[model samples]
Target: MVLRSSFFVASILLLTACGSGGSKNDSLPSETPEEKGESLYVLNCASCHGEDGKLGSSGAKDLSVSKLSDQQIEQIIRKGKNAMPAQEAVLETDENIKLVIEHVKTLKNKP
Candidate 1:
């Protein structure tokens, strides 16, 4: 009886350790385009541009006060501005560039 009880407890513990009761979807929720854009921006742009887009390090412009249109911004991002490197290689896709543009727009200072 003692050995049987120990075996049952061990089995239960093993199953619990294996995440038996966890949700079927163990993966984290997919990031929204905005979230992904912010992440990409942080990885690629935040060092000079800052988290709020106002740091302006290494001659990086204050993005919070930027007035460039989306098309202009897209051009700069794809081609390379004065001090900024061309991001076509870094961003890889137009979709990613658009997402980053959307995130950058959110950094504008409120009136």
Candidate 2:
């Protein structure tokens, strides 16, 4: 009887150990660079700038008409342009900033 009880307790512990049943976010697949960039942009910029990036809230520029190159844009993002805040921490790395720049370019062609 003791052996059976021990086995049952071990099985319970093993089952829980094998499966977290944690937050859904934990189970999600890792985002690609492009997807990560898009998410970051939306979270960081879309509110005042608008989804198309032409709202011009608080002096934000219309990105579709932006003449700035990727390097220039990256600088502005890292350093801040007038009302916009510097995003160095949020962007976290040069590669992340570049990926976000590409997504911003797509907004230019989008309606």
In model 1, where do residues sit more than 4 Å from their true spots?
1-23, 109-111
lDDT of 2 by residue, 52-90 (tens): 888888889988778888889998999997889998887
lDDT of 2: 0.85
lDDT, residue 5, model 1: 100
Q: What is the C-alpha lDDT of each candidate?
A: 0.90, 0.85
Residue pairs in clash, model 2: none
Off by over 4 Å in 2: 1-27
For candidate 1, lDDT tens digit of each residue in 21-87?
5755666678998899999899988999999999999999999999999999999889989899999
What lDDT score is found at residue 103 in candidate 2?
84
TM-score of each: 0.75, 0.68
